[model samples]
Target: MASDSSADVVIVGTGVVGCLVAERALDAGLSVLMLEAGPRVDRWRIVENYRNLPPSMRLFHWDAPYPPKPWAPHLETRVAKESEQYLQLEGPNARAYLQGYVRYAGGATWHWAGICWRLTPEDMRLKSLYGVGRDWPFGHDVLEPYYTAAEYAIGVCGPSDPALQWPPNAERSKPYPMGPIPFGPGETRLTEAAARIGMMNLPAPQARNSGVSYHGRPPCCGNNNCFPVCPIAAKYDAATALPKIEAKGGKILANAVVYRVETGEKNAVEAVHYFDPNKVSHRVTAKLFVIACNGIETPKLLLLSKDDRNSNGVANSSDQVGRNMMDQPKLFAEVELAEPLWTGVGPVQSSSILNTTQGEFRNRYAGAMFRMENFARSPLGSAAALKKGLVGKALDTEIRRLSACTARLTVEHEPLPLPINRLTLSSKTDWLGINKPNIYYDVSDYVRRSAKEYTVPRLQQLASELGATSFQLSPEFLNSDHIMGGCIMGSEAATAVVDADCRAHDHQNLFLPGGGAMPSGTASNSTLTMAALALKAADAITAQLKHG
Candidate 1:
């Protein structure tokens, strides 16, 4: 029962990147097998877990994300254990990094907040444009086709605005698979103010489907809890396409947590070792190996697999498997609008004030675009925002009002990279016995300066224009939950983890297809980039298999 299973390609982890790569491999005529660390999620059975709370209580802290069912406990354990490894904050008052991703068959996408923002062309071309970070070997133009393929695969919905794309971002070939989310209360007020102030209120791009069938997937029921678990198939999770893979002679086995990649005589990956649900050891072998675990797990898995051949880690001969962590700073401020803002609606607000459109994110000096998170607030966020943004007695009174008419400004922006801020393996181990991932990230001088000199003033002005009674700015740099890099992509083996195509530089067959490939995605949701990157990797592997 613990014998090795063979396939043309053995993909580790069944998250977004793994699932898409498996699909591409299957379509390319390769025998693929997806090895997962969690069990399969059943739609009909899982629906019973949703109590469906009232909209007001939506964002308050619940029972620590404990699943209502048996499977929920399993997921909780995995996430909690992993969170400890990657969720450490560098300073006090820094937002607790939210690394609460699940390991179930769908991985974290099943419970992901359905926001989808593309890393602008400038994000990929930071070095060439801003003269800051290293230049990506492949620019947005190179990944354009793959972006289209991946968007189609996931059923994305949004309005296409090629003109909206900042330099260094890939241009859109087609419109969003579905229409954009309608404007909500906060957005309406913000939009009105932005127009008055000569700013554009750009529509937010999302992974949620507005039509009946987006790439053959169902539309959302507006359940509102797009994070943690989505009952209906309205959202585009990578596991959305698992059925087709199974039908195409592909097999996905779960609870097989891959801790390390085993190498053969010639340093070719011989097998992958994982623990079953029963905690029994099992090994699976393949002609080639693909590493698609998310940012943290991907690098941790690599460090754990290090042998005498690599003192650093597997595919880490370049000593860059876990470096260059570049997640954006979460900018926040809240304002008590003098007028009613009316925010009560289903996933109503996700657009932003297009400061970049008026040349805010660009000055031929330093920049990255960011939008206000109007509809993305949780109860905790609202309470905290009120307390911080509002002063003393006014804070208590404003928070208690809970009026639909209110305004809060939260922005996620690209941050500068400091080599010290990275993911390294520590001597500590989790309950699972794998070495814990050590995340050492502090806000760079670039971001701190930008927040003070650039972001804060604009936010204060925007709020004032929106007729705010008061406004407050955060003193500390905030981190959006988007985790990326540590295992970055580049052409040089000595500098990065994988090449432009996302294949491991040291290993011919190993590939990393997720945010880990992105050295600097600025302040955008990484899901779309993850999809686009996977498609690019899939194409390269197909060419290799067919030729050699």
Candidate 2:
């Protein structure tokens, strides 16, 4: 066993949320330490890994570039059997929760599309507005300042014009750090086509640098490789914060898999126990502990930390620690257009139709956010052409035609935080003898009804407007990887795992922020919301530390 280390604040994950909290804590002059289960690697190493991948794996294998460590295993999406070794899924929509995320130092921000969507005021008051899902304890007004702070911290770029803003009446405290990136030929065509159908294709707020650099990172060069790995640091990722965090006197321990969160008097977290790759045990004590490991891992850790005092697991007094699992259950549509839209000129995702996300229809079913994927179709086109056994000029022509004429449209439906959708500790163990994350996910009739009644028709309309020769909508719901609600937040401690400040109800010194604490997901990427919540929690943590 190694000797115990100590700090003012200890964070269990080095992802964006953890990094955000660490930065703020460090800024507040609190000594911070971040423990990451995964190994620390340079951005260039990940870039090389992406470049060396087979063309077939390049598109969908977003986590392929960052191989998971044996001790800190994550899903290996390319191989189903291998992936099952980590996350165990069941239920009618188990496949829908087959989350694709990297267990590297930076976390999923390494492979995200960088879209920063703020939940509308109505989204926060789900129960009040539509009487479907749980409402947030606080409104969007309370989170607005944190949203702006998060956007600034992550170097978000978006249109200054309020008309182009998502939820245009959001009442932003500040403008975007940088201007919005102009749409590519494909996005431009789609925007025009969507406008004709009474839809607004507004510029999405993204973390990538648009023109001039805001932070130390360079402007986006349009590598069209935002996923898997951004070759250049044009886009924001948590790995970029590691150096800055260290520069600010914060310590980061990589390849340190934290398994148990030890609690003491009054059920406050006293220390956290971790294991090295060699199975050696180590302990670290802190004034406060923040578990910012994504939605799945955070709840999994809490459930794994069962003790004599807390038999149901730490922070599970309400028995809601690993319940209410949620994500934006997605429906994809592949469209073959009449013209050469020619996507892949800018970031992988730059704009979306957020108008669909807000509507009176939420009383019956979920609302959704729709977007035309900006990922280049060349690789998929080439694979399809090759399967036909075409040769020479014929093969080249077919590949070009398919690549230029096809586009993928996706609709992500809002999910209700149902207690039935839950995450439990599986009997199966990983390399380090820790129980794997077992999830029972059902996209529920809320999303399914939205797809069948609302979103599908809208998708067909857009495809028709784009002059589609052929259109194919996915038969099943897919995972957006925007995991949320495992440690759901609310005012009452009896029903929720965490409070509005993301502070665990069972423990005063413990905070669990990010996606896990979010009560509702408004049909968009949850990263920005996660980041905003992290910032909000950071403020609360700072106040608690300073006062107590």
Candidate 3:
């Protein structure tokens, strides 16, 4: 292997977690090198791609705008070929695990909605409080300061009023960097309805500038194009950090797929091997290695790097590297209200009913976070009306009515980490001859019971509150794309892959921080938690390099 480069810290993946870690390492004066598996493209190009997409593809196919590179393939669910898919999914709830993330330089943040939700203290102690799911190694207090660091690092904007905060009165080290964005008409109506029902529709803390420039990026202009690509650099995608990271003396190699993790004495990670677009291999040695390749890809890479010293793959001494796959199991309700709600006027998602996220009922089943999907319904309304063969003024009237009246209600349930839900290297290989990831997933009875007995009724009640003339609930569970727990963390090395600081139990220098290391999938989005873990891991890496 050609060992042509080296660094103080080598991070695999260029997602928010990796980027955050890279920034922190550079701030500590450490030489950092990041390897991204996918091609990097300009933000304007992605915006143009969305504008040119077919109306059908542009509506909900978030990954439609950025075409995947052959060597760094991600699942293309809209594609006709099942045989060529990179993720081979199986089990009864396989479709629910069909994630919407991409293998691009910025990772899924390129198309994320920028929702940043922190887990309640009770959320990390599921096994102790709820008698289900694994408890995190540390308490929420230990993670609290890191959460604050992550918020400031990502430039999060949120409500100043504690009443509007999720887990009202939850302790915070510092206030959000900016105040919350104003709600659209639909969100305003829903917030009032939620208050009537004894619930709180809190503005979601988001990683975007409010009305002024933050962290050298422009504020959101309410273009309602957060997904696919933010036309302006308003949202905090890791792609935007690439230039700043480079400016800070951090090196990032795009389209360099790290396939094998090479380990040495005392089971420490010594180097990682990657393949260029042309299939030529290169080796990069570093004092420390951090893998922030989301949930699926992180575990997939670990399971693929099997060696004689660690036959089950590095950090898989307990056979837990690729187990406990999770995502927030989602169910949707499409409701047509009697009054015009006028959604889609701002960001795609701005608020959610977080009160449902915690309760004593969690002992029996999972808790959930409910939200009104704020994406504009106009495209869907027009498509449906067109299919009805309507034209002229009649068509226009129906389109306007349906667009203004319809709203998409969503419920995402917290998931228990089950050993049965796992990802393994498949016989199927990609263009570079690396085994594709095969996953077997089941939302499990925890999430299912929550949806069937608890969340579904709540959705119906919210629909009634909206004065819905008609409503339809989806029959099957959907993927919220908040992936977590493939490299489950805990105090015990027997059952977990990573420790309290997100360092691999078996490999001292290998840090796996992100959704994959989370022990519990809290009902809200997991990106903030992942970012917090990354920051915490970065601290650990800095201490290790300085002291060890």
Candidate 4:
């Protein structure tokens, strides 16, 4: 083993949250080190990989370009046999909990849709106001400034008008850095159709350049390939920020899978142990440590690092490290409209109906967010046509017809945090000889009741408003890829892993910020909230260093 390495601060995982924290720390004149579990990937390489995919795999294999390393295996959703080897799942809704995240240098943000939504004030105080789900340690007001900072950091574009803004009443210090992306024909038609039912469809705030360039990124050209990989760098991804951090003198180590966190005097984290691809081990020491890995991997790493003083885990004094897992349970409706709506023209998603996101009925049932999916239908329609044994002209005609008339609408419901839905280390080991993660997940009655009683009926109603000839709702719930609530935050140490500032209760110098620290899943994409929490933690760390 090499002699112990040291730095002013060390961050694990190079996702959006991790990069943002590194930027903040480096700006504060602290020597920072970033440890990434996956290899450094480039844009052209990922684009080439996408182009090489077989036609059958091109439609849904978003993680194919960023293949998982043997030593650091993330869940592979494309191949069923290989995916089952990485994660051991058991629960009533176990299959629905399969998540697709990349372990590459920039993490899962490489393939995200870039929709950014801020949680409402009511969302943070769920328990006190509606008698459900645990409340966040602080309300939205405390995190609002951080949200604005995160938006600017990521280069978001949204409407300046309050009527088109999300959460319409959210407190804003200024307008978005760039104006909102124009609505395409599909979105315009969907917005009008939704209004007939007394619902309002608002423009989605996204992390993509709208008109002129900002932060050296070009404006979006509307190729509609936001998923899998963006051919152009118009969309914001952590990979774009990595170079900026390095330019500011931050050091990054790739393919270094951290396995153990060493605890020293007073149970403070002194160093962490990681192994290279060649199985060579090294130790890194730092004054302050931040684990910005996403919800699942963050807690999994904590539970893996067990010591004599902390037999359960490093930060598991309250045994809440890998409990209270939450994700937005999703359902889909595929409908064939009587008229051709021409459903694909711009981004994969641009607008959504916001009426059902909150209400007094939340005391009884879960709330949901609904959107019309804007993915191009040619690939899916072609596959279906081939399955029906059509050929040549018949196949081409059917593909075109389906591409123009078919529309997919999705409903994502907020799930209450349940301790029973948890993650644990499996006896099964990976290529690196480390234990695999096992998950026990259930959408719970809170989401199920909402689906059967409210969401499903409303979905049918929307399809009717569009004059659909054939409409079918998926029977099983799906994962929205918004993993949250593993190392949850709260005011009480007995039930939480982190505090309002995202600092671990047991280890003052350790911070775990991101979706894992989120106490509530509010029926929206959790990336913006995760970034906001990271900014808040960064401020706290900077203040502590100043006092010292």
Candidate 5:
């Protein structure tokens, strides 16, 4: 058995956020430990994990049978197979369309279509201006510096001109750590058509590498597969940062699944008790505990840690830990261009049409476009979802067969919170003895109506301007697996689980960092935001530790 370790700070998950937290916290001279539930991931050896799986299943397939295909749902299910079917948050969702998901050491970063967009000033002020959503106590201006820092650290590449008329939020401090990926021929045709119609379109920023090196990491050769694990280190994965933290005297215990966070009578967390791979129970004590277990796991962990001391959950004083489940509603529609456009070659998520002008779903402050390349309808993924989602084959054979030649663009829109969608404990347990994530989501009438009524027509118009044969939201679509806000941040306990600093409200020394604390997801993906927030939290912790 490995020797138990301790530290002044213990970060529960070694995902990107946790790593950034450790990096910043370590620089501030704090002794830290990162606890990971999976094994130490060697990028080269692990790239094989991406191989041989069906293209449809590649992104979701991790650790072999452990995840099944695509990815397993974190939701509850009395029967395992039935649970997998219900867990898809996308693609033919039995109900709400929030389908695709995957889990790995790097967390979901392993297979994301790399987009790093900042939330708009409007996104933060959801309540004041919109009067429908909650307001972010914090705003983009506050995190802009960190956003720049993370962009460089994670090796982002793009041509941004916040001043540019199209594809809003394109501006950044330095040229990307990696230079921008030029628009492919297929996207270029669509761009011209968009220009013809006065709709803005531009190359979207991507997290994949365009160069041979950045901060000692290799560049992306346009690996078609961003899912599974990047065989080459072209894309940034949190595992890349893990070793640096470990090298700095940080102890990382693997395959140790944490079950409960034991707290003192005063409500400060004392230790996290977990089960090892061998089923041995162990405990790690720390001055502070940080939870970076993604959105679903973070809340589930907090709620599951209940004992005699706290019944509702460790930090359930607010009773809002597992509420406000948010998923970005995606609108994937593109015109079949009159000419052949080689759309399948470059990295996924290549470009986006910037939307700065106010509209129904977006106001001046809402997020901007997060465009990309390979919204390619694979052989199976295409033929099935006719139009946007499929009911039959006539649409599939005609529209999907030519996917190899079509130009693709997607609008990654933010969705409001679904109160009922959450991570609750399941009545059943996996063979590993850990309870799987159980979810219950009810899509709003507003979302269904808006997507069908508004977003779809816009995408169709885009395709038409480009001389597209057709365009429509897929017959099947769902919420993105990029889950956020299960445990939101706010000042009032009635509304949040953690505060702006990502600290647990009920436990002074415990911090919950990651997408779980995000009040709202920006235009791009959450990895960039989570990383920046982790830095801020680490700074706060270091300041307090220094004061004492």
Candidate 6:
């Protein structure tokens, strides 16, 4: 093994959370090193990859554009038959646990819809308020400042009117960085239709620019390709923040798959061992280390790094390194409306009916957020038309009809952390001969009960109210990609992997930020919360360094 260098801090993963932590640490005048397991990729390259995809792959373009590197294999949900290659899923809800995350330099943010929703105050104290799940160590009021900081860093565009804002009651220290992106015709119509049912459809706060540029990126032009790849750099991705980190004196080592973390006296992480694409191992040492490799990979890395001192795993003294897995179980309904709603004029997901996200019913069932999916349906319609054997004008007409009339409404339900739904090391190995991540997941009775009793029935009623001639709810739950809860945070070291500040209780110098430390999964995209937690952890790390 070669020992090249060391830094003040070493961070794994180059996702939004990792990049944010790097930027903050570099700003504090600390030399930082980031290790990304996958190869560095450009935005235009991803766009080109999407464009080059065959018609059959276009429907699943999110997974098509970003192919996994050999050294850093991510889950591929497109090929159902090959699901066991990277993630060996088990249990009743294992099918729904097939996550869609990329291991590239930018991580999963490259293809995220950019929805930036904050956790409500109630969302923080789930166990206290509703008698289910675990509460965050701190409340929303504590994380509000960090939430604001994260929003400004990512250049969020949200509604100026408090009514349209997410968790409209959230205490705001400042308004959104930019005004809301105007709703497209589909969203406007859906909003109006929802109003008729006494439900409110509010503009979604997104990480894309709205009007004037804030962070050198141009405003959104509404090409409606927020997924797969945004042709323009209007949407915020970790790749955008990465260059800023490098500019601020941070080094990023791509294709460095960190496999082992070494601990020294007092259980402080001394160094991490990583292998390059050619399988050349290198040891990189640092004063402080952070594992920001999302929910799944972070725990997998911890479990993989079994040392003589910590045989179970690094930071597994609590035996909670890879326990308490959670995600927002999602279901959608495909409906053919009586009139043309024209669903594809702006960003893919601009608005959602969010009132159902919280309520008194949570004690009995799970909470859910509902949204009208805004992805352009032309590709799906065209594929369906072709499969029906339509030709020429018939095909074109069918495609247009389906594109204009069809709409999909999705319901994402919050799932409490379940220890049974855990991530363990699989016997299957990847290209580097490291064990793959095996997850045993079950959504449990909370999600299943909510889907049957509340979400599905409400969706059926809404579809009927929208004048749907053919409406079919999906029978199986799907993964929302809002992965959370593995290295969960708590007050006690015996039950949690990390503390409130995201510091690993077992390893004083190690920090595990992002979704892995989240105690609960709210009914929203978790990137914003993950980023906020990263910023919070950065502050804690800075304090520790100063004191030491």
> Best candidate per lDDT, number?
2
How far does residue 188 in candidate 6 sit from its true spot (Å)?
A: 0.8
- TM-score between model 2 and native: 0.98
How high is the lDDT of residue 179 in model 4?
Answer: 92
TM-score of each: 0.86, 0.98, 0.98, 0.97, 0.86, 0.98
Residue-level lDDT tens digits of model 6 in 461-518: 7877777899888888888988899999999999899999999999999999999999
RMSD values, in order shown: 4.8, 1.6, 1.6, 1.8, 5.2, 1.8
On the 0 to 100 scale, the lDDT of residue 365 in model 3 is 89
**In lDDT terms, how accurate is model 5?**
0.66
Residue 239: error of model 3 in Å? 0.7
In the range 1-548, model 3's lDDT, one tens digit per residue, is 11237999999999999999999999988899999999999988899999998888886788788788988998775565842377788998987888888899899999999999998988988889879888888888899999999999999999888877766646888999999999999999999998898768999999989988899999998989889788897999998999999999899898999999999888889899999999999999999999988898899899888898889988898899889888898999999999999899889999999899898999988889999988888999899889899999999999999999999999998888899998999998999999989989899888888988999999999999989998899988888898888888987888899999899999999999999999999789999999999999999999999888
Q: On residues 1-548, what C-alpha lDDT tens digit does candidate 2 reach at each position?
A: 11238899999999999999999999998999899999999988988999899997888888788888899999887776776778899999998899988778888889988889888999999899888899999888999999999999999999999888877777888999999998999999989999998889989899999999877999999999989778888899998989999999899999999999999988899999999999999999999999988999999999999999889999989999889999999989999988898998898999999888888899999999889999889998898899999999999999999999999999999999999999999999999999999999998888889998989999999999999999999989989999999999998999999999999999999999999999997798899899999999999999999987
Off by over 4 Å in 3: 1-4, 80-84
Q: lDDT per residue, candidate 5, 376-493, as tens digits?
A: 4465336444446645666655564466546555665566665666667776566455665566665455455555665566666666666677665556444566778888889887
| C-alpha local distance difference test of each model | 0.68, 0.91, 0.90, 0.88, 0.66, 0.89
The sequence of per-residue lDDT tens digits that candidate 4 reaches over residues 125-222 is 89999999999888777888999999999999999998878777776987899999888877888888889997788888989899878788889888
Sorted by lDDT, highest first, which candidate order results?
2, 3, 6, 4, 1, 5
Number of colliding residue pairs in each model: 13, 0, 0, 0, 38, 0
